[model samples]
Target: MPEDARKRARRRLSIARGHLDSIVRMLDDPEVYCVDVLRQIKAVQGALSGAGDVVLRGHLEAHVATSAGRGDSVELVEEVMEALRYR
Candidate 1:
């Protein structure tokens, strides 16, 4: 992966980690609002999605764009399709 993309993905994951910690703490508090917990959960999901996007973009730029000349276009397409199956 490119250095910049790796750094950005790591930063988003760090934010997600912090939000996950907050969610755990909130779970321990009997008075915490359910909506607030859901919001934190959403934040974590968005961070994870952002990380996935960065990695996919990097892959497309660094590999997929060159697969035709590399003679691996078929395999690369399948791999990318599997990776994006959830999305």
Candidate 2:
């Protein structure tokens, strides 16, 4: 992965972790609002998705773009397709 992208992904993951910890603490409050919790969960999901995008872009730039030259274009395409299916 490119150094800048790797750093960004790590930062996004850290934000997600902090949001998750906040949610856990919020759960201890008996009067916590459902919508507030949902919002925090969404924040965490967005952070994770951001990280995924960075990693996927890095993988494409570093590996997929070279598949044809490496004679594994078909295999690489199939692998990426399978991964994207669940994404």
Candidate 3:
């Protein structure tokens, strides 16, 4: 929720959007190589992974830590465990 975190998230999303656009362009252009497409796919995956890390860090630092500080650690742990089960 901090301005810096929001900016970083936005930047990552923008990179993802650019990757999508590149894929579309590649599809339209017959000369695009198969390896190039694979590279773009990897880039998109890495960007998404980076974004997930950012979000997880924020959640741990803000929500989880705060909940634990407030003596609601058990609830927070249960919620995380339930989420993992669903995953």
Candidate 4:
């Protein structure tokens, strides 16, 4: 992965981790609003999605684009397709 994209994904993952911790704490608090907790969960999901995007872009740039000319793209393409299927 490129240094910049790796850094960006790391930052986003860190943010998502913090949000998940906060959500766990909130879950333990009896007075916390359910709607508010749901909102935080959504925020964490968005952060993770953004991080996934960075990873996907890095793979496309560093692996897939270069693999095509080498005639070894089948596995790489299948892996990307699997990821997209679940995403």
By summed lDDT, the worst window of 10 consecutive residues in model 2 runs over: 78-87
Could you give candidate 4's per-residue lDDT for residues 1-87 as a string of tens digits? 888899999999999999999999999999999999999999999999999999989888888899978888999989889879766
Pairs clashing in candidate 1? Answer: none
How many residue pairs in model 3 have overlapping backbones? 0
TM-score of 2: 0.89
Model 1, span 8-80: residue lDDT tens: 9899999999999999999999999999999999999999999889988988888899999999999999988
Model 4, stretches more than 4 Å misplaced? none
Query: Could you say which candidate leads in TM-score?
Result: 1
Model 3 ranges with Cα > 4 A deviation: 82-87
Predicted structure with the largest lDDT when compared to the true one: 4
Q: What is the full ranking by TM-score, best candidate first?
A: 1, 2, 4, 3
Per-model TM values vs. the true structure: 0.93, 0.89, 0.84, 0.88
Q: Give lDDT tens digits, candidate 3, residues 45-75.
A: 8887777667656666777878956999989
**Candidate 1 similarity to native, TM-score:** 0.93
- Clashes (candidate 2): 0
Selected candidate, larger lDDT, 1 vs 4:
4
